[model samples]
Target chain A: MICLAAFIVFAILGIFSATHRRLAKQAFWCVLRRVTFKPCQASIGEILKGKIVGWLLRRKSRWAGWVHRYFEVFSWIFVIITLVSTFYTVKGAYFYIRYGTCNPEHPEQCLISTQAALEKGVINPYYCNDK
Target chain B: MVENSWKSQFPFLMQKKNGQPLIYFDNACMTPCPIPVLEAMEKYNKEFFSCGGRSNTHFGRDVDDKVEETRELVAKFIGAGASQEIIFTKNATEGINLVARGLNLHAGERVLVSDREHNSNLIVWQVLQKERGIELMILPSKSDETFDLAGLEAELQKGIKLVSVVYSSNLDGYTLPVEEIVKLARKYDAFVMLDGAQAVPHHAVNVKKLGVDFLAFSGHKMTAPSGIGVLYGRLAHLENLSSLLCGGHSVKDSRYNGFELEDIPARFEAGLQNYGGIIGLGEAIKFIKQVGFDFIAKQEFELNYFITRELKQIGGINFVGVDDPKSRGGIVNFYHEKMDSNQLTIFLDESANILTRSGRHCVHSWYNSRGVKDSIRISSYFYNTIDEAEKLISALKKILGLV
Candidate 1:
């Protein structure tokens, strides 16, 4: 689970750094192993655990103990949060591409649509809701 | 730091991370450059940056002189017959390739290697076996993981043409009985080449006295800059050996059809040489001489002994290499049964600024053959101090949940 979250994080960071790109590749392989039901060779996830735990151990000992104890639960939470955010981001991009508003039901809340709508004097949800 | 130590001489040791000195124990991979080596390269680059053995200008002449001086320095350092025996290369890998291809082995010929050879040494022979149909035999070590002289003799009896092995095992820090290996190879009338990458910086190897046909090592492993290596070949063998590169400095008389090759070292060194790296390597060798090998050996022994002795009390750790710290020199490797080496390595880095190497360390064959997945290797040098070793012990103990 942590490997999944690490893959996403490293995949995004891979755009800038070669070091992160290598970790992204490692995380990709670990994710593949997990999906295939093989033993997870989650070297990236383990390194991430060490980094997070090591950082916390230095600054916040109580948080470090809690994190070390429930690392798996935190991994699942991270994965869930990432998945939910990804779904909403993709949905928003699709609505924006098709209807000129990130949210068709609440076009006024989206600044890109709100600014354009304000210029056209149609600052109401009903304008984008027609689609 | 030890008395009269070269620790303060290294600029990397002077650097601090999070208000503490960074503990660097990855010297087997490459040593950090000292002020002298860096200054030499910077002087070459800043003052007279030109191609050696090519240009006729003043700068080129200076480069040529410096390159030749470095060649002499390397030759003297290794106790070679002449400076012509030293061939400058990019790294030990390139040097190995130069010899492997230059030998021009035929089908059905045999080359013997140890079971614990590095990828650079093993891969070339494997390629030769597949492409050229040469018989490549791996001589197995003893149960104790040391070099098996009997197994070498058995392989030699089968008409082995060449014997190529690491002078010191990078994985285990086990020094091979190279003298005996060379003696047996001579009995079988086989050419011997020693991969001296790990041995050159830590040990005093005299090619004239030790008597191996070819020896290869990288400059970066000895506190010089990267992209520079040395391949010392016997004067007779280098003359007979085929050149792997062509054009520029390689040729003497070129025509439309064919050309005559240049002499010994120049023949092997084909293109424009790395003038800066060569100058830096010369300075590094000079600095090493100033520090002396006796001090280096003592410093490494003290640090490695402390590390191994402390690690012994930290249970659940499987030590790599032979048990003797003196035999292992500066290298000490191990892995935890509960924790994978990758995480342990990162934890060591995160807890303290302890730089180390992990995984099979380019010797995947040894680990795969033994069914071990990973390992954490801690290789020290003279620059490392006891304080760094103590910090590494503390961090490792914490990582292992001992504290």
Candidate 2:
């Protein structure tokens, strides 16, 4: 039910956004611009020379942008990974619920031994994977 | 797919190696592909790669159309009354397995099989006998590997329920009289299944006129890609049998308590099928139609006669079956006086780059029945020339001299 809701929402948004070309282009460009590398405040000399060796040297810390970049990359990766995993889980669950087995092709026939089916109780009759 | 002549269809066969044009004599095992099959597969993979019948979208409908188009082509090729009678399977192995498992054979019910069957037919029955308590009865073969009709009739008199036989012997290249066998089996109410893995490519098969209960054939052996096969069941027989595999797509409606299965073909297909392979297989059949079966059979017979004449000169080599072209299709299986088939195959590969099927050709029981271990099989296609047969005979002599 949740997947269906999300799919419907996304499909409608996709249709609406496809028609609004300027807004769609602006949104895509914003993401592209955000991911692109920016000029760093840290000078080459300061990067090469450590603070302990050159106490007289003064430079601004680029710690804020560096931290932001790390968080952005990590979050983007996390979102993509989460979405992919959710899809797999949904597919697996769908087949399991529909046929009472992961493999729909040989449902009536036992791919596994009868003993394994008795022990696992509908979990993976073919293999004794840890429940 | 647009139809083209054989000369225009497969230019690959005309390709030359070492200033000599190649000759392909390996059709009984696998045939060379024509351009239409490759193009169809490529077009589907690029344009219609989606789940068919599962999703209600343009791409999904495209996939469904492609799959059904192939099914119709295959049905027409075999003279099936309706496309719904044809079920797409992975290969001849899976197609046979589908029948083996789907039909519930009891402990006392008998399955009569010939000794000349390929392992695809033999081992499946054996597995069923071992697992399901079904009894398997073996029918004897003639010295030339032809079906012993009297022996089969004697067995039939004993009240057998099913008789599965090969339409053509891949080991010895003899074409069985399937129409006679079918008529005989029908008299006793015994179902007949024909393994057309060898015969379908070389000749025309009218399933309706043949009046067999089922016919199984693979695509790869007939210029299509591998991983695709057809299981043609009479619609009435399929209606009586229960499918072992059942899933969402195979069902019409469900109330969480009971479900109704779909019609013949849909009820049999329980998962995502090989859509591209089926589409390509359809085009392959179209290509074969353009070449004309009469021309194909004549070319194969001429080549078979030429090979038999050449091999007869190489004395001490024994061909297992009758050497008459009228009796066989294109396969010619023989063994030398004192040469291991594997060793000879290796020698041919190394010396002449000739490809031939060695060992029992997946029909171990056939060899076991003859009290022999294995034989070398040189099967030919229409594309093969008389010169290649001579070259193969020359290579056999060289290998035999070493023995």
Candidate 3:
């Protein structure tokens, strides 16, 4: 799910960039290179930075490079967040499947188990005694 | 004072992610199943784990009895005349398709659908038009996003065979005048089918009182599992409408040349069925009944009204439908002229842990026709509260760069 989310973001970015003639060529080329595992003449970072901050770089190279670097950092942070969230979500699902609760310590928090108990008119043995 | 105690019933509402409480305002898309509903499904899977409606074994018979009991309960909940009127499907989309494909409209016959229908309701008719040479008529809405009754009357005069429409708009939560629409359609001898996917969860739908020939809705939208949905047709319609699928339990007897079909509901429901989901849906209806529609409506209204009032103070925000919160259901769809909807949605998710939906919301034709693009949708439910609404507004303010 996390990979799909990242791919969707990239695809949307690619589509948005397609409106720009120069950036469209570069974006498509980047996609092609990534798909085929071909070595590109320019690094992806350089290509993206040059395209996005090219105008800024022409006027103020230092400021543009600084902003571009921050952009790269933010992108990595977003990716990391997505990965961590996806890991937890998958982990929760596994726990729920195995124990009928995402968190065994708080069995009432397990929706599946709670619902099962509720339907059967029985108390959730793990959490029923807890206030 | 309205008791906000219902929030405790949904475990997901209590869930925290990244040390922040997950504020879910995407109930229109789907709702998290309450404990009882989940329990019902779990009970089915754990204790009575058997194929339903086909086996003579003790477990199978018990499962069959439970499935039938669920059918009766669903029928009673929706005010259907009999349990046979309800047919279980994979989801509302399949229900709509079953009706569209089963009705067997002839060439040049027309079907009228409103402009605000979700893609599921709209695309099926379009497909029918393309394949069967049937004319698809668009029932235009009034400026305030309510159904144009006069426009529907005009269309009815032109001889429509069927009038299929959304019970409530998923985009803006504006409910069409279904009672009036049904009366008008009946005057022209037209069959009426309502896509009640949005309406059924929030409102008490009495098909008999509404006088509609058919109503389809998804169980997941109303706190049941995803795979289960209900298609309620009047007894006569179910008896006459062609079965979309065949084989297995759908038939009484079969041979190479010919086969005998079962009764109304069973004839339409083919294969083994989603027994777990069906049982969960039964429990969901029980939960809804216990909560009562009046309380649900009041709770949703409080949240929606509060959010709408707050959103009005924000600059650059344009609401999709009527300005009055009372005029719509629990949905608030808006777009910022200066901000991208998707970007705003992501910002809210990342910054505040508030989940929402942004896009054309499956009403692409409505957006495309009006030259409007994407919008953000915040749909509140009974489980949501004013505090959550306030949180959403604060997040929106920050995302709009207002704070």
Candidate 4:
């Protein structure tokens, strides 16, 4: 399932690259490097110098290089987004377990937390349906 | 205005992710529980958090009463003759398995199913066939994905013991002709079981009116919480079917050598039940009643028509199933020539904040037969709006370069 999810993420990044080239390239590099920091240092030509890209380089190096450079920045952005989302999910689950809510300030948004608060007799304003 | 107002009833719809309003179009997967249903579950956990049907304590007794009341409501909702005919399981898969495994079938007996059945309905029968030496006949569908009634009748003539079919296709949302299928099965003296996991949420299904012997559905698909499902069977069939699980609540009396099983529903529901989910389902039924099927159906039809029309305007987009949108429920499965369906789904989710499902949708048999691997499925419920559909269209156009 994780592999399928990664494949889907990359595929979407590839498709979205059509309109948003720089963002997609940044996303691709960020994911390939597994980093959440600044992605300007890594060049697309270096990233695309893999076996398949190598074979393409042998025949159409200019085209392959162009494609790699185009998608470099956006790919890094996608990776950063994915990493941040994963971090937030883990944080949310932890909060939900400890405090019965994903967001401490907005406990009403989490049903688990809301139910827990209601059981404990804590007034949850978000779920207030007295009317 | 109707869309905006109805959408507000679900709190999850009010959520914003990445500065975009969440456009949830994956209702067929599982619906976001509305406030009423959530509150109903909260009430159970807060006030009567006790084991049901087994204790003599006041709390337990009260919980049991609420459970039975919910059972009665469910019975009335599905037009069952008595509440005892309703057995609550973990989910629709468990309900279907209870019926599939409990039914006493001899070797060489056949079970008929449609070509478009979900894995829950198909895999259970496949296991039964492998274990019991029963023949599992898969009836074919037409080019448009509608079941071939003539083909089903031919299979029925071969002396089928049971005919189990999905009431609606999860892949393309094509609804089966369950009434006609049940009538034909009756003529063949075969019992009919309808997997109502998808159907019950969208349609007002009455088991008695449909003349089906058994029906299975999940609460999560109908604005209720997960881990609660219903298996509705005829009283006579319930009496004859064996209990799939045996434990504390299922037995009437047990001796050193022999044990007497309890009657109907309790005999089937063996372990401690999901009281919170069951109570929430009762509330879901109430909410559905308040909304009314007329409103639900009208809203779904309009959303489906609008989406299909918009999709048709986009080039390189092909929809699965019949040409008429009304024939299917509020689901649209389409593929793009320019991009993978999985990729398109992710783009919709990440870029557009619109959620949709993609893949074979647990109906790999249909895909395997057609040699088609995957497609994108957009399922709309009553809460979905025209604006959401427009967002989806706009996203698809941008992703596929149709803009």
Best by lDDT: 1
lDDT of 4 by residue, B31-132 (tens): 988899999788889987899988888989988988999999999999998999999988899988998999978789999988888999999888988899
**Candidate 2 lDDT tens digits, B183-253:** 88988889998898888888999999999988999999999999888999999989877776788678898
Off by over 4 Å in 3: A1-131
- Compared with the true structure, what per-residue lDDT tens digits does model 4 show for residues A14-126? 66566445545554554555445443222332223233233443356455445434444544565577768878888888777766777766666666675765455543434
Give the clashing pairs for model 3.
A115-B35, A115-B39, A116-B39
Question: What digit string (tens of lDDT, one per residue) describes model 3 on residues B34-70?
Answer: 9998888899889989988778899999899989999
Report the number of the highest-DockQ candidate.
1
lDDT of 1 by residue, B225-327 (tens): 9999999999988877887788799989899999999888898998888889999999999999988898889988999899999999988889875788878
Better of 1 and 2 by TM-score: 1
TM-score (C-alpha, index-matched) for candidate 3? 0.78
How many clashing pairs does model 1 include?
Answer: 0
Worst 10 residues of 2 chain B by lDDT: B1-10
Native-referenced Cα lDDT, model 3: 0.82
Give the CA lDDT, 0 to 100, for residue B160 in model 1: 94
Fnat value of model 4: 0.00
Q: Assess each model's interface with DockQ, reporting 2 decimals per model.
A: 0.43, 0.01, 0.02, 0.02
List the candidate 1 regions with Cα displacement exceeding 4 Å. A9-29, A38-44, A93-131, B1-5
